[model samples]
Target chain A: MLTVKHLAKSYNGTKKSLTDVSFSVSPGEVTVIIGPSGAGKTTILRSINQLIRDDDGEILFDDVDMRQLNRRQLRDARSHIGMIFQNYNLIEPLTALENVLHGCLGTKSNLAGMFSLYRNSEKTEALQLLQKVGLGDFAYQQCRNLSGGQKQRVGIARALMQHPKIILCDEPIASLDPKSTTVVMDLLRDLATNDGISVLINLHQVDIARTYADHVIGINNGQVVFDDRTAALTDTAVTDIYRKTTSSERSLVYEG
Target chain B: MIKPENQVSLPTQLPAGPRFTIPLRFRDRRRVTMLITLLILGYVTLITLPTMIPDHFKLVEAITGFTENIKIMFLQPHLSNTSWLSLLGGLGQSILLAFLTTLIGSVLAFFLALASTRRFAPTALVLGIQSFMAVIRAIPTVLWVLIYSVVFGLGANAAVIGITFHSVAYLTKVYADSMDELSPEAIETLQAMGLKRPAIICQALIPYLKPSYLSWTFIRFEINFADAVAIGAAAGAGGIGYQLFMSSSFYFDFHEVGVMVYLILAFAVVLEIISYRLRSSNTAQH
Candidate 1:
């Protein structure tokens, strides 16, 4: 389980990007955060992994405060937490299987990592993960050759190789086609239901979020406007979340 | 006029056009001034050219003398002091010197680049190393060889050290720039995966930068070859360049010099072909 409390952030001491944001994600469930563009949805997801350090906040994951950990401890903590990006941030020059093997880089020694000395079991496991993501044939293909959907699937396999307790996805399907969107979403849903891993996603598509998310958190102007079960997010609630800022309200600074 | 079914109604009143305080004609005055200054400089240089020549210099006679030398050099090319086999050996020595310098330089540059790139090191360290490299790069490679010769006493050792020093600085800047071109997203992904710095560099950075590194190192090799040839004569480091120097100056053999020039040209063309192949293969992979 992941719990964020009183999350506050300001870039370069300018206007606030996130204001006292707090939320909890339960295991065995898909929690989707829906917001308008520049609503700090990316900020919230990145904060959980401490990718961009939050100014003031308590990010507690499995009773360990993520913010308080030292460099080494933070790395150890991060190894169990998987992250997926909209761009499918696999090393484009590497083969799919080689990229998947990189998931265990944090666990390897410096010398072993430098030499790329992966054991037979690790290679087999990476191949199996690729198969699981329906990319068994593309395991040896360079990621730059893969289509957008295939690349995202490769990313999913890479995250799974971490054996993550919670997977944080920031707009994973934003660049994907409709067919690929359904495929990626269904895979994330399966990971939650079958694997019992907590999946937290930031999305712009309300209908898709409604379809896959067990719990929905609606954000407006960096604050959580609605946090409830998916069934409780009515049409009006989504409208409130995505409402455009008026000319006067627009003067209030916001960073995308 | 009937509206298209899908077309929306246009706005009744469009906003005003963007306003500027300065007049349009005066806005580009700075450019006009720069052009005028360049024209004046050109006129001055053209007027002063003849006056700058020495009193003893005779243009027609000098041209005739130069053509005579060129005619003898190209039309009657032959080895005088050194045999053909020895010339080949000298060429081999220069090639080896260039290859050895490039190898050592690239290896050292790779590590220094890792430290100089912004994503890896602190701001202070990055700035320090970059500025230091800038100073090293500012000095000419031949000048560096001369400087090192003062200590190493003008031999292959001094030439190697000087050439390698310059190569490292040059490669470091190019390598770092190539490293900078890497997608920040990839680095973030690796860091988020809890991969330490060394692992990140080895697993992700190295593989991504491999093609670029190869191309840049080959470019440096070409440069080092030219530098080695130059320093061979300048620093008393024996190579085909020294042979060319000895034949042309001491023995006054223009034919031997012409032969050496042709040999160098052949080798240069071969290097260019190899470099082209490397570039095409790299792009194909991409």
Candidate 2:
């Protein structure tokens, strides 16, 4: 389980990108954050891994504060927290299996890592993970040669290689076509439902979020407006969560 | 039917052309034409200025003499003083010098390039290394060789050290530039997965940089070979270049010089073929 409390960030110290954002993700559940562009969905996900250090926050993963950890501790903490990107982010020149094996880099010795001395066990696991994601045949193929859907699947296998407790996906399907989006979303959903891994996703497609998410967190202008079960996210609630915020409404929120 | 207020009404007889044209800001057609014309004029003036021959110079006789020398050199090239085996040995020495320098320089440059990249090192360190390298690169490789010749006393040692030093600076700049072209997202993904800097470099940077590194190092190797030949006579390094220098300047053996020139050209052609083979094979693997 993970809990983020009072997370705030500002680029220029003037305009807040995220304001008092608070949310929690449960184990074995697909939690999707939905918002329009620049609504701070990405900021929140990046902040969870401490990738973009936030101005103020308490990110408690199993009651350990992620923000308070030192360099070594943060790396150790991050080893258990997998992240996926919209771009797939696999080293294109490396083979698919190699990219998957890279998932365990946090657990390897520096010398071993430099020489890429993956053990037989680790290599087997990587190949298996690729197989699980339906990329067993393309294990030795370069990632650049993979299609978008296949690449995202490879990325998923990579995250799984970490044996992570939770996976944070930042618009993983943004660049994907409709069919690839379905395949990737189904894969993430399967990870949550069957594998019991926590899945936290930032999504722009409301319909996809509604289909896959067990819980939904709706953000508007850096503020969390809706946080509840998917069944509770009625049409009206969805509309209200996505409604444009005016200056007066912003001022009202600021006052409150 | 009423048109929407947001929609503008069009004239029944529309204008045939645009009324106001957007002018070119900095490089209009006329300005480009004028600039090119000025460059041509400058080039013509430079060439014509060099044609101010001395009043009594026998231009025809000099041309004929030059042609005669060329004919003898090309048509009757044969080693008179230097044996073929010695020339081959000299070429081999020069090649070994180049190979040694390139290997040493590329290894040193790899580490320095990592430090110079902003992703791996601190901003101050990156900037410092980059600026220092720029200073090193500003001076030509030959000058560096001569400068080291002062310290090492003008021999193969000086040539090797000097060439390697300049090669390091040159390769570092290029390697760092190639490293900079890697997508930050790829690095961030690795970092987010808890990979350390070294692991990220090995797993991410190295694979991406392999092709570029190979090509750049090979290019530097070629340059080092050429520099080795030049410094053989200049720094007393003793290679084929020294033999050519002796034959042409001291003995006035144009045929021997021609033999050396052809040997160098053949070697250069072989190097080019090897480079092409390497580049194509590397691309094919990828």
Candidate 3:
């Protein structure tokens, strides 16, 4: 489980990227954040991982404040919090198996990781994860040669390699096609239900979010405009969430 | 269905005096600048050519003498007078000098590059190392060798030390540039995975830089090889270059000069082949 309370972030000390965002994710649940571009969907995910430190508020992982942890403690905590990116963010020159094996770097000793002295058990698990993500035959294939879908599959396997409690994805299917998008979304949902791993995803596609998410949080202008069970989310509410509004119009409007 | 009043009119054609206009403000200036540069270079060459070759007949005579000397040197080489053992030994020494300097220089440069890269180090440290390398590279390798010879005394040691110094500076700049070309995302992702800086570099950055590093090292080795040869004679550093210098300047043995020249050329060509093979094989593996 993960809990973020009153989180706020501003890049230039001016316009806020995230404002007073609060959310919680339960185990074996898939929570999707839907927003238009620059609405701080990715920012919220990054702040939880401390990739971009939030200006205010606490991120609690199973009731422990991550902000209060020392460097060593934070690193240990982060090892269990896996993250996937829109670009896959794989080491391109490395093979699919090797990229998955990299997930063990934080857990392994520095010297062991440097020399790739991973134990046989670790390698087996990495391979299994790859197989689970449908990349068993392409284990030795370089990530550079992989298609967008394959690369994202490898990304999922890599995140699973950490045996993470919570997995955060920043538009994991943004660059993927419609078919691949369904496969990846399905994979994430299966991981949540079967593996009991909490999944938090940022997505721009409302239809995909509605299709995949158990709970959906709609964000606009750095604020959470709507939050409800996917089934309870009305078509009118969805339209209102994504409706184009200028700064002048925002001054005339208020949220209850 | 019958909403004729609500139908929108779309314009089919544009009203224009000129369909397209060329923006020539910058283009015309660039052309004029290039033309002026060419004209000045041509004029300078014209004025300097006569001074460069004071007499045409002397130039012709010198060329004929050079060709005749080459013919006599290669066709009727004084093989008996040349010592094969010493010549080979000198060649070996020159190669060893190149190898040692490149090895030492590349190792040193690798560390300096890591420290100097903005992605790895603080801004002040990066700027300081970069400026320091720039200063080292501004002075020619020969000048660096000469400076070292003054400090360490004239010998192969001085040549090796000086060449290594220049090589390090050269490689630092190149290696840093290559490292800078790596995508920040790779490192950031690793960092987010809780990897330490060192682990991230080993797992992400080094693999990306390996091919470029090898190519740069090989290129620097070739340069150091040439520098070793030059310094051998210029600083009395005892190598094939010294023998070549002696044969040409003191012994006036053009045949031996031709032999040495051919030997050096053959060595360079072989090195080129080896480098090409290495680069190609590396790319193929990747």
TM-score of each: 0.91, 0.90, 0.88
Model 2 misses residue B158 by how many Å? 0.6
- Model 3 spans > 4 angstroms off: A249-256, B1-57, B73-80, B282-286
Superposed by TM-score, candidate 1 places the C-alpha of residue B176 at a distance from the truth, in angstroms, of 1.5
Clashing pairs in 2: none
Instruction: Evaluate residue B165 in candidate 1 and report its C-alpha lDDT on the 0 to 100 scale.
Output: 98
| CAPRI grade of model 2 | medium
Q: Is candidate 1 or candidate 2 better by TM-score?
A: 1
lDDT (Cα, tens digit) per residue for candidate 2, span B58-160: 9799999999889878888999998999999999999999999999999999999999998788999999999999999999888988999999998889999
What TM-score should be assigned to candidate 2?
Answer: 0.90
Error of 1 at A188 (Å): 0.9
Number of clashing pairs, model 1?
Answer: 0
Per lDDT, what order, best first? 1, 2, 3
lDDT of each: 0.92, 0.92, 0.88
The residue-level lDDT of candidate 1 at B42 comes to 99
Q: Each model's DockQ?
A: 0.57, 0.55, 0.42
- True A-B contacts kept by model 3: 0.49
Kindly list the per-residue Cα lDDT of model 1 for residues B1-286, writing each as its tens digit.
Answer: 6569968889998789867576666548789899999999999999999899999999899999999999888887888788999999999999999999999999999999999998888989889999999999999999999999999998899999999999999999999999889878888899999998888888889889999999999999999999999999999888988898898888898989989988998999999999999999999998
